[model samples]
Target: MKRTTIHISAALALLLGLAACTQDEAGFLPEGAEGTPIVFTATGLNPAATAAAGTRAPVDGNWEGVSLVGVLIGGTVKAYDVTPTTADNTSATLTSTDPHYWTNHDDITVTAWWPYTEGETTPPAVVVRADQSSPTDFEGSDFISAENQPVSYGNPTLRFTHRTARVTVVLTDYTEGMASVKLTGLSTENGNPAEIAPYDKGGDTYTALVAPQSVATGTAFITCAFTNGKVFVYKMKEATDWQAGEEYTYTVSLAAAKDPGYTVSEDGKTYEVYNAEGLKNIAELVNEEWKLGINITLTADIDLKGIDWTPIGKDNNKAYTGTFDGGGKTITGLTVTGSNKYAGLFGRIGSGGTVKNVVLEGVQITSDNSSGYASGVAGNSWGTIENCSVSGSVSGSFSVGGVVGYQFGGSITGCSSSASVKGTQRAGGVAGTTNSGATLTACYATGDVTVENDGTSYAWAGGIVGTNGGNSILACYAAGNVSGKGSGTIYVGGVVGENYATVTACYWSGLPDNDNGGATKVDGTNVTWQTAVAAMNAALSGKGWQYELKDGNSLPALKKEQ
Candidate 1:
């Protein structure tokens, strides 16, 4: 329960809402409405500034979490503060709550410098120097690095409040000498009406005292209000905090996050936070043995460096979320290798999030022994995936797929796969087996899929789905060579092996050969290619997927529900 700061903007929300409404309009044009920019100023600690001694002691008051409030910057103690300026719509400040140097009764002045820019292209580089004793000269300085390279300090990273129009002080380093960390600078912005509740963490207890509900009557977005009426807004990107307190009560304020760039890797088992530039790929900063939950956003291209997934045990359940804009750059040349039955990049994805503009390429697997399921990006998919692709080889004795081995609901849209897949029983190019209702739209598969004889009865296996218990396959196409043999019964198709549910607007040109088959093998009842195409084409009628058929569109349009 750390004291974290998050900001929201009224204008941004309105714009986004408008965009969403016009997304489906035939002639909708994207409005080039740019955002506003803001300037930041640093507040310092005065020499004669005095406070109640041992007032907000670390182990005294009801604490929430750990935070880095004060730091020794350029031989002086500096107080962290966020100031406002004009052009407040476009820019933001970057700060963190990671551990920093702080001491009580220390005379440190936080000075504001202009045009903080880095010279190095790599990250983890030493940027600015924050020293001790005084803010005038650099004594003991800490360099901020990006991509493991020394870079110049860039722009000031600050958060603006949109609702309350108030500047929130994210207490990074706190001491007992300051009596208590207090936040000031408020304006009028109507936010949700709520009350402060009490909670306890360690041995201390505290209440989250928000501004009185009667503060304003209009809609209030969180904003950082400066001395004047300068207002800027920001949004919180995470769920946890590291402030030093038992229970942190947020009163409609913003919180700083752990800077992903220029972070010290605590251990080899947990994930590493690289400087902004050092984030090469998803594999560079993560591990399989440790469970450290981290949220991040990348401003540059990230390299995965060909890493495989770690097994899912009690020790590893780390969840990662955030935005990674590749600047229209492609995320490729990566591999996720595994041998066990339940091994995958996201072994257990319990959270509902997005991983886009990514490629799971050249995935090679050997072992087929799995008690549950496995896939390239995830073992079990219960979320959504968009604008992604996979190219790999999978061979297992049980359930397997190019994208996911098992899916229990959720959606996969704007994605494709081109991997050679093999499995003992349930096998598919996109999904091996599905238990819950899921949708795969505008997704195509072009892999050689096969199912082996495991000396047991087999049921479902197809180019798109092994068995279609109750999943919908829309605007999807498959061109894979499928071959399988079953004792009790077997179902194989160009799109799906067995269809107990619906298969709409999908096309399958997978011809059964001398080794495989010509069409679907359903309990010895086979459907010819003409029949399959007719049924699939019939389902396309008015759906956007009509183009997936012979004389229709090439790709499917995104559905409202999906």
Candidate 2:
């Protein structure tokens, strides 16, 4: 019986060995063999070459979930799914359940595609629906791995490239009364039935994935519709070969398109001619259908002292929720005199709003209402305000500030204010009140803050922020005198009148005259007037604050005059 058992075991081993050899003969080694595992990597190609010569260009986006088809030297093809292991899809591992494993002596050619279906001769043509998201497209590439490779375990690598081109259209110099822009005649170059869809990337940017084809001369056209019910058509004059792994960017300026050389189509259906002009000023923008998410770019510096200025969104019912790009232009000599609750260049700025690269100089904002908000920039802001500077005076009965009256949530970074602030309740050189979701960083204020109330009312006055409620103030300083004179409770601090949250690496200069007034938190360091200059320069320099001494006696001003 023992002899019979040995004979059966030997026969079973032989059968298994034959099965392994059968798999090896089919162009794949048996599993668990002493060989390296094949790895597949995929990366997107940049749209254009970098300006630096001989430098490696950057990839556009993260690519993943690519289907790889490996054809062996003997014409035996196998399919494997390769998924990205990292977020960027720079590297991926090939996964398969086939019994055949790659060997050192094997030579294979591989083709890769995204959104590929199993058992398909060619990848399906990418069908982009009208509602498809921006950047919707498919990519394919082919590569060949030569013979006589190393036989180390887990060492073979394969890379895949993109075989399609992408195009991006940006509309610049946008004037008022322009509603929407559309690009047409983007079909197959051969006049095939293939349809291509361009996706909107929001705010005058459109992107489309195009197959490698040659566009017909003078066939492509773009249309811009204005609010005045006029349409303009721009015919393409130049053409190029749309190659794979390439990106093309087209910037269309509305100001340039308004030239008489371009054909203007007045009829909505057919192409006709119509003369168009851009809106004149901000007052026209305010009178138009200005709403949230609108993009406003200042072309030139606006002087509001001479014009009859009306603040945009002057009430809580209507708040500015758009983008205001100052283009490094200054709005000087802006004066606001009214008893309105909200008074500023912009009355209220809601969430999702942004104001940047703006400077307000010699502005005077005053509010006579007992409980109101007043500022040089905005009365209330819950959005982003960056790289902005204000030098003016703001006076109000309640919340008053230089940049913003009330900052609820969002960020105020790389900003400064040298405006004198006076309020009956809360007054701050930069911001009156900051809530929990607000963050003030890398900012400074050099204006005096004063809070005066005759009755038993609370007066909060600070050089940077009047009332800080569970917010974050980092690497900020104030070099201004803070005074609060009231019969009731008064809080005055050189940096912050009251503190509830964290303040890190913050400093304050000048003495607080009120004995009862001091930085609520001991973390805020105070430096005297004599050593304040050097101390501030040293402290700010350590935190990467760009500053320089223009005059010997003056404090270190921000490099941008903050």
Candidate 3:
């Protein structure tokens, strides 16, 4: 209920002119006079702006979906059909199903309407379906008619107007989650309240057609149901009678959603968390070991608003051991300032734990004092992390990284980070250090990695891992600048400061050369930001991974659904 701006507008409907006629020896022309083919050229079937299914009109300034009618002066009539001339359907030409002709300058009454129904001798009745979920149904509700125009030899011209009223709802200022809109309180012709389903035009727009009807005041009409468990109602304050050929539009601005309380997923294994409170509650439950292995899913984007946050698995002994599926949602404004041993959104991910499809935005985590492991995601990862990305700033004393502070025997796949990181010992764009047979595949980082030259015996900075200790690194790249701060020699590399085991098809765009304590420039491929997407995808092919280049990103990122 944060947003209060709701605007409505009603506008007059535009009318189009059309002419139609039919063919028969009796209705053709004057008796015994050789008749010429009556010329039928269609015009003016343009759709309203951004109207869902608006472009489906049969005419490109010509005719489509039109049924032509020619009424002889003597009360005889016939209907004909038309076809478009261009393959692109930009224009139309008449193809009379029942050909007709005029002779001796004979005059007759003509009628036309769309869409046409075959086997009907007369103009069809308006067919307005209650449900408009299908776009064609909504378009079919648009009954336009041009009735009773005198047609003589040359060309027939008639005017058409919509017989049903149109209503459109557009949601504005939408920041997160999906919206489902419904229209209620409109009475059907039978005088009972009718619930109308509109056709979604994508981009938060929905449109529907309603037959002319009277609506009473104080009636709840528009309802917007959001995925975050927020429902808004718009009721009419004044009685308004809907009329034919008129259009109504309602624009509703949305706001951040509040916590939706506790909700469980259909499988019952995964409980849904909607807002900041729910997220904090989930962390608490896991930390207490009561729900340590229970799955959790995010149902909406959460904004912490710069409040201090404690990592989920702050206690290493009770580390998170369950799955955390973000459901392609974003977690924003995660701020933490500490010098604890483990620091990040999650301090530790225990064995058998999995986190995927999670996006962290504008996070600020710093552990400036003492030696601590820190990253945007987890400080010590001993489990699987996949299809997740982080963006912001992260710094620590010893192990520091944009993604994970330490990969102590686990796997990270299809993940990326663009958070600047700093540390006195091991620091990198992705993880600070990895050992014990850890494997990384199809991942990249674009955040600058700075290893402070505090004269530490083994300070190193790399675009990917700070010190790869005999681990498997495959199909990964880094594109951030790696530099040594302060004094003393801190080894830096474009890809990894040191590599002991397997490193294949890996690339770097940050360091001038891949030369380091272990693998050198010859061990890795160098690609620019412009050419990295194809290279990463090519390298990751057959490896069950693909890279995509996003706007304003210098490195290829793992694909995540919105």
Candidate 4:
């Protein structure tokens, strides 16, 4: 690392008169301020001590036609040619035909790079050489204006550090017949200098500018060529955070490539080897393992028909605490016909869990237990669900919904459900019940909610939520027909059967069919189908909701759903 100082000052009152009279078309300082020059003093510990002698030498007289310094002001950068004033090349003055100067009060940033073009403002990509004989060298530094204090006469110093890291791969204890090896999986392109490193090859070792962040956990491919004309492929696992100006080395032994066998192509020109077992299916994942804090990406849409399905987190006490990224894939033909208490793909979602980018299509979930929960996604949720949708049928005895049976505490955003929900006690198109700490935003439901109960049992059905216990519901709407049939007190509403929560910017359309004997009411705005659509569009658009008009649909659906 090296440190430098840049001095910018205005002359005394005597020179102000001259500066005011020298204003130019390029927006230089006024005439009287002309003599006040911006000076740059280079001073710092050498960054590359082991490099060649002239590598860290200052670019003084040699920088005549090159951009030695760049001044960034108001989001625009202006390069300036440098003219050394001293013999040591420690101090230099900026020279420009248009008098390129900045005011002392103007906040600006300065960057210094070697071998830069005359008018180039953006950093150039450091070229990478695949051959071990040739290698490219690149470096850059930046200084912000606010970090340094401005003086009327003195210069404010700045520090510069190497913006790239080095990585080396060592082959240890290799077989005698191994002739060649190649590594892949490292990123080779990045525009942000601080986040990603440009690729550079140096034979067995690679040196490049890499982002100072944690490297994602994955397998790196290693292809080896043998002297006997046989080729073998191996995968080396790597996980670490690469630091700037730091060197990392990885050692791999050839004996680690244990496998069933390698497959040969019909052409006999290529040999393919399987690294590890492929991703497990939904049923296999539920029966064999539980993933916590790990990300599960579904590679393809799953069909769970005619399979003995056990809900995740049901057999084991451990709840789902990892992230399930469906990658816009749907799980269709899901049939849960058990008498379990919690019946869904996920029995319960614990805190810090996330389920996103998934859709449950044509699912048929039913719980025969007298007091149980069933839904298309999760039976009970205390985590986050985003950009998810459900379209199916869910039936249970107690709590049942299209998306979630019970939202204990968490957030549900950009989600919708069109699954018909039926329950003996509590049923809703979106959620059967939501706690006070739960938040629902940009969610909607269009499925009909029905509550079938005996004369003595209580029934509640709603378009969105059967019961809201002081939860926050924002930017949500429902158009489902809610119905309740029972002798006991039945509550039915267009939006919520029982409201004891905060509902904002929510609307409901289509009145409930049968309202039985209970103190039930629609909490949000109740309007006709057309008026509800218009009002919802206006309100949601004002709140920056991304929506699109579907063919033959009165209201716009969320862009994420589409």
- Please list the C-alpha lDDT of all candidates, in the order they appear: 0.45, 0.64, 0.72, 0.61
On lDDT, the stronger of 3 and 4 is 3
Candidate 4 structure quality by residue, lDDT tens digits, 322-435:
777777877777677879787887777788988888788888899998888888888888898788899889999888988888888997878899889999888878888888
- The parts of candidate 4 lying over 4 Å away from their true place are 1-290, 455-457, 513-534, 537-544, 551-553
Error of 4 at 372 (Å): 1.1
- Using all chains and alpha carbons, the TM-scores for the candidates as numbered come to 0.42, 0.47, 0.51, 0.47
Model 4: residue 387 alpha-carbon error in angstroms:
1.5
- Going through the candidates in the order shown, the clash numbers are 95, 0, 6, 14
What would the per-residue lDDT of candidate 1 be over residues 127-241, giving only the tens digit for each residue?
2221111322211122111111111123332211111111122322211122222222222224322221122222222222222222222323233334333344433334333
Task: Tally clashing residue pairs in candidate 2.
Answer: 0
lDDT at residue 82 of model 3 (Cα atoms): 56
Off by over 4 Å in 1: 1-329, 485-489, 513-562
Clashing pairs in 3: 18-158, 21-69, 21-70, 23-99, 23-100, 60-90
Best by lDDT: 3
Error of 2 at 307 (Å): 2.9
